[model samples]
Target chain A: MEQKTAIEAFAALAQETRLGVFRLLVQAGPDGLTAGDIAAHIGVPASTLSHHLGILERAGLLRSWRVQRQIYYATDYEGTRRLLAFLMEDCCRGLPELCGTALSDLVACCPKPTVDA
Target chain B: MEQKTAIEAFAALAQETRLGVFRLLVQAGPDGLTAGDIAAHIGVPASTLSHHLGILERAGLLRSWRVQRQIYYATDYEGTRRLLAFLMEDCCRGLPELCGTALSDLVACCPKPTVDA
Candidate 1:
């Protein structure tokens, strides 16, 4: 991703409400959550949640699709990966060894959720 | 890093000038670059660069240490790593395999510089 888009993405995430919303969506995975569900989950008013979702959508950090009468929100995983790559592009002077342990730990700790049953 | 600090860091990085300064520092590695040098490299006025640097420093994305009269700036690798990890903690629903290819490509493309000479 270019610097401008990266900045926008970062800006979208640089908020308490938005970050919570984004994280909730990430946890929800590709299945995503409806706008009403997100508002309830984050304990934010519908209007406030709408504003936050708009920011995330504008930043390209999220994607929404209508399933029946509900709009589902999900993380744009590719966009997020691009943003992370851009931020860490020169990480530890490009020496993955310098960042390997941390990256490994992150991966380990962030294991994908199994069946929600 | 906590959410608050992460938000601050993201806010610091959300700007054009500050992001330029931070990326310059990230590229500069542990040796860092002096404020004057950064101003020169990014072609911004000293005063403007100073403001940008101050924002970055306050957000903990950049660290400065004085060596002689020159203040060198470097990326806080740990801080950065923490931020990236936080953002990607639930990436692809914790499926590293989903992010592995992109992550590997990023690491490969960002190899550390061998020597300045």
Candidate 2:
């Protein structure tokens, strides 16, 4: 990803409302959530959430489709992953060996929960 | 990291000049870069680089110290990692099992280049 695109993704996710919306959509999985559902969970007016969703889609962080006159939004996994890669690329200097420990440290921070329990 | 802190970090990195400076600093490794050297490499005046550097430091992406009457800056591993974690936390829902594939996919994108080459 180019610097400009990475910056746009960061800027898009930087807002509180936008961040919340993105998180909700991510958890909702590939099927995503309807626009109305997002607005309700976010506790914001439809217009307000719509504005945030527009920013997210523009940033390539989200993709939406109309199903029965209702908009369903889902996290753009590829786009989201691209942004994460962009952020980590510099940190690792694109050299995994050199940054092995650092990468390991970050992974450790993400402990797998006991989902099977 | 809070939304405010994330926004500040995003804003600091959103600028072209600042983004360049940050990547240079990150590549410079934990030792960071001297103010004068960064200014020279970035092809910016000392004042301009200083301004960009100030924003980076304030955003917690960097940490600097005075050594022998000169300031040296380096990427703050902890601070940087915190911001990354914040971005991923929601996507993973704090449940690694749910995001296992997504997490793996992102790691693959970081394919460790052959530093041995």
TM-score, one value per model: 0.81, 0.80
Instruction: Give fnat of each prediction, in order.
Output: 0.45, 0.30
The CAPRI quality class of candidate 1 comes to acceptable
The local lDDT score (0 to 100) that residue A61 gets in candidate 2 is 92
Show model 1 residue runs off by greater than 4 Å: A91-117, B90-117
Q: What is the lDDT of candidate 1?
A: 0.71
Prediction-by-prediction clash tally:
2, 0
User: Which ranges in model 2 have alpha carbons more than 4 Å from their true place?
Assistant: A90-102, A107-117, B90-102, B105-117
Q: Give the TM-score of candidate 1.
A: 0.81
lDDT of 1 by residue, A13-57 (tens): 999999888877765667789999999998999988999899999
Check candidate 1 and list the clashing pairs.
A94-B112, A112-B94
Q: Candidate 2, what DockQ?
A: 0.30
Best by DockQ: 1
